[model samples]
Target: MKKNTLTFIFAVGALIFFSQLSAQENPLSVGFKAGTGLSNYRLSGDMKSFTSKMSIGGSVGGFVKYDLSSNFALQSGIDLYYSTSKLDSKVDKSSNKLKSLGVEIPLYGIVQGKLGSGKAFIGAGPYVGYGISMKSNGVNLFKNSNEAGKLVMNRFDYGLGGIAGYDFDKNWQINASYQLGIADLLKGKGGSMKNHGISVGIAYKF
Candidate 1:
């Protein structure tokens, strides 16, 4: 319920932003992109006191973009991403790390402006991801109280994202973006954990 509400709000907000910024329609373009991402988990609710270190990962994907006007466009893409995080506690003498891989889909509403002879774009939207693999290394503080579980994370992840980029030419683009997770990653959790991160990459349109 909370996850659905947040996703819906983000989608609607992107639509409203796009509608107001669109000016002239342009043709569609397809592109490929690859980049590195840095991520970490934010534990909230009952787990607010927990601490985690940032994770480093990479993403490779393809995207399609349709220009709503000369200055606005909509973009969607699919990417395979790898994420990891290290967890620790101050009061409790325990430590753990999580590693996961997933597929992500992002729907971004973009606004473009002239930058000298090139173009600059900024986009924001919502993204949803499904974990292909996830595991944790630490004591299974729940079941055995000494053994780690095989898989400890939920499959679905949803959040809000924002991206900004510049086109150096008709074919090359450089961009950076961030994802703020709203859904809890742990399934049947004693607490809540969410993934959030930033990515910087390059893209080529062909």
Candidate 2:
């Protein structure tokens, strides 16, 4: 029994050591990640102050990384982003919720370094999103808001984001990021509503 236990321990140690070595040698990788997180927009308009609740949201996506040197790489990907937030107004006695579905593309300039048996990285860059659909309280907000039936939101959104992460092994990693919307979503309205949120997720490399 003691011999069998010793063998198992050695095997685990060997597996970890080799995994680290393999990661160091590889300069390029592709991976997929999926996770849920909290989301809320930077509100505007007269009722913007009433926005209080953050909605739960998530993304499923894949990324590609290409090393530029020992300490830098370019990372980019497409992610399916879904987010919602709740708005309540006491003065008007109104409660409403906003939801959006979009596809996002991000290009990050990442700096990577070795951290003990793993690797760590930090990145920041610009991102763009195109909305697939948007709604408020089960009503299509993209539809006519005026008597002429014109769209209210500009479908394109652009932002900046920062990310930091650690890769535990060649195949597993965890990351967190924050995004700030730079472009207004309002078509021609005076008020400004922008997207901004943070996300944490796990990724697997192939």
Candidate 3:
């Protein structure tokens, strides 16, 4: 219920932002992007049973940007991404693993500064994610499900993200970004799941 409410709020906010952008004189630009992402899970509190590891994946997304001024813009996008990680066991002989597919919606406010003919930009934003599907491979170290009789994997996550990039021209840009999950993604009571990743991608503006 909380997850659904948060998702609704973000969707409404994005809609309002885009609606306002439509009234501006120079409102819209569309683009295609592709990038590689690294994913990891972090454990917090008293998580003695969990271990952290890294996974490499990729993402592709389409974005619409609204130029608020010569120095600022509002950008929003939807992306499809995959992440994988392994959980090691210190006491047990078997390890648990996970693979997840997610759909992410990001809304960003970016500040652009000039560096000669090329432009440099920094952006920070909030992102909401829905885990479309997940697979548990490897061995099952935990034998019991949650209170709802569901596996301890959560289907929703929210996070903060930032990006630094340079535009060579109106149509070409490159960016490096990091996203940190601010919420606990695991459904069970014991461990926390967070993702931190670096991505490099090229964008083509139209």
Candidate 4:
């Protein structure tokens, strides 16, 4: 119920967000993008005492953008990303390095302006994600715990994202982005774990 509520709020919030920011409509464009992402796990709620280190991974995606005008646009896309980060506990003598692959659906409102002849853009939005794979030390993290018989991690991840970049040409773009995850990763609830990610990538419009 909590996860559903959060996703609903974000969906509604995104609609309201762009409706206000975009005044005029322009043409639509489609693009392909690839990049590297650095991610780390954040402990929260009952799991606040834990720690994790950042990991580098790959991201590939395609997007369609609706030009609200030369000054603003709305973008949506499907991104596939991977991450491997170490999670540890101070009180418990345990350390785990998790690797996961996930897909994200993002909706963003982009603000565009001129920078030295090229166009610069900054945007903020929300994303919905689903994990296709998650493992720690050769063990599946999404499976049931051997001793507890409860699921170890949740596959559903939803969050807010921000991005900024420059368009060197009508068909080319370079960008940096960050995603702050809001959903708890723990499935059956002994605690909470969330994800934070930073990515840099390039895009080619079609």
Best by lDDT: 4
Among residues 3 or more apart in sequence or in different chains, the pairs in candidate 1 whose N, CA or C atoms overlap within 3 Å are 24-69, 140-147
**Two-way lDDT contest, 1 vs 2, winner:** 2
lDDT of 4 by residue, 1-206 (tens): 99999999999998876775554433688999999989997876667666888988989999999887668789999999888887776777577788999899999999999899799999999999999999876778787767552238889999999999999978899999999999998876567788898999999997
Model 1: residue 186 alpha-carbon error in angstroms: 1.6
Q: Counting only residues 3 or more apart in sequence or on different chains, how many pairs clash (N, Cα, C under 3 Å) in candidate 1?
A: 2
Task: TM-score winner between 2 and 3, please give it.
Answer: 2
- Between prediction 3 and prediction 4, the one with superior TM-score is 4
Candidate 3 local lDDT, residue 124:
97
Error of 3 at 146 (Å): 8.8
Residue 66's C-alpha lDDT in candidate 1?
86
Backbone clash pairs for candidate 3 read none
Q: What count of clashes does model 3 give?
A: 0
**lDDT (tens digit, per residue) of candidate 1 on 1-206:** 99999999999999876775453433588999999988898887656666878978899999999887677789998999987777777667577787777899999999998998789999999999988777665323223232343325568889999999999978999999999999987665567888889989999997
What's the lDDT for all of these models?
0.82, 0.84, 0.79, 0.86
Q: What is the C-alpha RMSD of each candidate to the true structure, in Å?
A: 9.2, 13.0, 9.6, 9.2
- Please state the error at residue 84 of candidate 2 in Å: 1.0
What lDDT score is found at residue 88 in candidate 1? 73
The candidate with the higher TM-score, 1 or 4, is 4
Q: Which stretch of 10 consecutive residues in model 3 shows the poorest summed lDDT?
A: 138-147
